[model samples]
Target: MSTTHQPTPATARPVGPPTKHQLAVMIWVAVFPTLTVLNLALGDWLGTLTPVVRTFVLATIAVPIVIYGLMPQLHKLRVRLLSRA
Candidate 1:
């Protein structure tokens, strides 16, 4: 008996990393809402910190949410949209 392998369909394939412009857009999309929420949630607490420290704190909170949370969902959306076309 012989077996033949079939190529995967485009819709079933994994998407690649974003291009530079796409990455810029993703960062813009992710960062804006992250910063807004962080500011609303911790504005008073962060006010006493130095500017650098405040920036660091905001990044620490935002990076994980963007990288692990928001980026993945956006990527899935991108894949879905592209597959539909």
Candidate 2:
């Protein structure tokens, strides 16, 4: 009689790609309405501002906020992807 252990496949972990159902729900919940609202709202607000002011405001507020918000997550993802490759 013998005892043995086998490693599970990496895919066995409940990480990585979203399922089809999850992707569909994510699109409905996050993508569709946000895109429509952003386009409508930003179009109106940008139209109200002069082009130089619009550029300045967007650069001052939106760009920094977006970069700060996204950079850590993007760095983590980059490390993970590069390690995998």
Candidate 3:
């Protein structure tokens, strides 16, 4: 006798790491707010620098905060949420 394969249901929870598109969204979600808040808080101080220098400084600071500080927390949240499914 032959067996038939069944497709996963639409509501099925996904396993494994996020897809490329999902990762992009997660990065954007982490980066936008961090950059906005930093820019608002440091606007006056950063104003003295040229555009390129300002961008460089912002990126340098933002990268660490996003990667080290925020990404871990976000990943935890994702895992918790997915686990509930």
- Model 2 lDDT, residue 1, Cα: 65
In TM-score terms, candidate 2 sits at 0.48
Per-residue lDDT for 1-85 in model 3, tens only? 8785543557556567877887898899999999999999999999999999999999999999999999888888877677666
The predicted structure with the larger lDDT, 1 or 3, is 3
Q: lDDT (0-100) at residue 63 of candidate 2?
A: 48
lDDT of 1 by residue, 1-85 (tens): 7685544585366667778998798789988998999999999999999999999999999999999999988888877775555
Query: How high is the lDDT of residue 13 in model 3?
Result: 60
TM-score of each: 0.78, 0.48, 0.78
lDDT scores in order: 0.86, 0.55, 0.87
Q: Candidate 3 has which clashing residue pairs, if any?
A: none
lDDT of 1 at 30: 83
Better of 1 and 2 by lDDT: 1
Cα deviation at 6, candidate 3, in Å, is: 23
Mark the 10 consecutive residues where model 3 has the least summed lDDT: 4-13
